[model samples]
Target: MPRHQLRLDASSPTIIVPITARDVTELDQSAAASAAAPAGAAAEWRVDLFTPFTDGGGGDPAQAVAALERLAGLLPNTPILATFRTTAEGGSAEIAADSYAALIDALAASGLAAAVDVEYRHPQADRAIAAAHRHGVPVVASNHDFDATPPTEEIVARLEAMETAGADVAKIAVMPRSAADVVTLLDATERRYRQARIPLITMSMGALGAVTRIGGGAFGSAATFATVGAASAPGQLPADGVRAALDLLHRGR
Candidate 1:
């Protein structure tokens, strides 16, 4: 299948709508919704939430590949970011490091996904990243903190680390306990954005940090995840709403 990966734009971040489903039926519905998203939008298949991969990551590789093929067909025009988020990083699935690396390798080789999300902290993360690149699939090396936001320098270091690890794009999401934490996340984003070679995706999740979803582009984030139906993460405004806000903020640029 021809890949139509969404190109990230720092001055005007692209909107990514996440699709989470537990079964094929729900997958169909969610995919349809994501497919119907406005132009310039992309879809993130939250594979961890899917039933096949929920059983301790013991899901069959062939079945997973087949499902992704079906999903690709459904969203033919939309770029798909295949992600199997692990429980250690605020995800629902729990799989061994080797299995995780193998799964990512398979997805990267399938030619069905425009990109794949690799957990930067996973034990086999380096192996997974190398495999994905070997297959010519761009890797979005990501880290998520659900408890609290790390210091600005720590966040910046993580993003830089992802770049050093050969990721095509670097992403980080953090939970904020106060308004200042949100600033810290964005501050780190800007500091990194000013010097980084690859695109960046950073956001402070939750109600207190919702502004990042709308205005992160100004801080140099390349994309922001939104929602068409069920959100994969917190503080995710609806796709249309986020798009409008982004346009308004970057208008006349």
Candidate 2:
């Protein structure tokens, strides 16, 4: 398929498949999963989620870069997101801000990543956003809440902040404490999709929020995250489940 702008609508719900595999065997497993993904889903290769990074507290930055490059080569044409999510954001590793920026720069420079995920709250995020654009790579300005879901107004404000920070796609992942919280996220997503010029990706994490990932496209969420084996976040459905749900939603529409 040609490189198409990922459309976030009933017809096509953007899917971001995770790359959490460790060695070449696991990487191949991820690739196989990607190849077998439903027709409309996109791939998100998360290098930091692999066992190597977690087991060794993350290896040399150069090694990580090399690994990303190799994985990119394996999964050609799929949109790969270089995400080194920090400890503060529920990610495993504790990479320094400067080093993280350098890694993003190197990935962009190498043309290995289609986009990079930068936290909206990070101090150096603006610089990273600028650099990614400079190298012709898109940036997904992201925020995550492991504790609890903020109100709908707060979610809107957070997305607005990401937009102001120069993000191509504004992403928010919140931990929903109840069904009502998921509704709040959906409401915010609908409002932002209608008002904001850029694409919006919103998900409420944990068991209470799993349905949002399945039904989010109907509420105007741009993408949903899924893993090949283990979930990167709580309440993440498997790729097949996501595909089936999206298909059912589209059919119903």
Candidate 3:
């Protein structure tokens, strides 16, 4: 098994700017924002929500792939995570599982994406992981709870399952109803990170849990998502905002 640690030295507390725009111009803007940010690591092009990939917008699979290729060429060497989150998994679009799997395969084949996000609950999760590994790409096995945060034990179990299923990194995003819920997520993250072999990325959503996005690294979160403009998840600070928060946290500001 390949052991993957958080690339803290490369980009400690990296920022992932969401790209919700459809136009090529907007894509350029998103890429530029990512380039301008202080994040040491690569940026993610959320192709699912971006303009050319969304439903009824002529953002079919071919167009999405073309956009990715274009972005990959433009952002040379800056790792790009290709994510086409499905509606079943808190994403705004609805693409069939088989089609989604094929799209991921295409991205992997192109050698354009450094990483890919695959839902832990997806029926094709294993196949996706295998394909990513075969193509020398890393896989993020992710789970999101938009309604409520699960209990600490359940959270640990879910993360463990992702790890066992062959994910290079396991991510969990939950909607917290209270401050105590944040504690539950933190505790789960810390415990899982210490006990598990794979890297862990966990966060609690909403204003009540906003601090988690800032201080989550201390508890073993490998990465957190931020946006250039619109937040993909609640409580996400903008890319620059996260960078500033991390700087202040590290400096004790």
Report every candidate's CA lDDT.
Answer: 0.90, 0.78, 0.77
**TM-score for candidate 1, residues paired by index:** 0.97
Query: Model 3, 90-192: lDDT tens per residue?
Result: 8777666677777777777677777788888998888888887887778888999999999999999999999999988888999998889999999999888
Model 1 — which ten-residue stretch has the worst lDDT?
55-64
Best by TM-score: 1
Q: Model 1 misses residue 136 by how many Å?
A: 0.4
**Candidate 2 residues 31-146, lDDT tens each?**
87787776766677666666656675544667767777777677776767778787788887766677777777777776777788888887779888888888878888999999
The reply for model 3, stretches above 4 Å from the true place, is 1-11, 51-53, 56-60, 251-253
Q: Which has the greatest lDDT? A: 1
Better of 1 and 3 by TM-score: 1
Give each model a TM-score. 0.97, 0.90, 0.90
Residue 173 of model 3: what lDDT?
Answer: 94
What is the model-wide C-alpha lDDT for candidate 1? 0.90
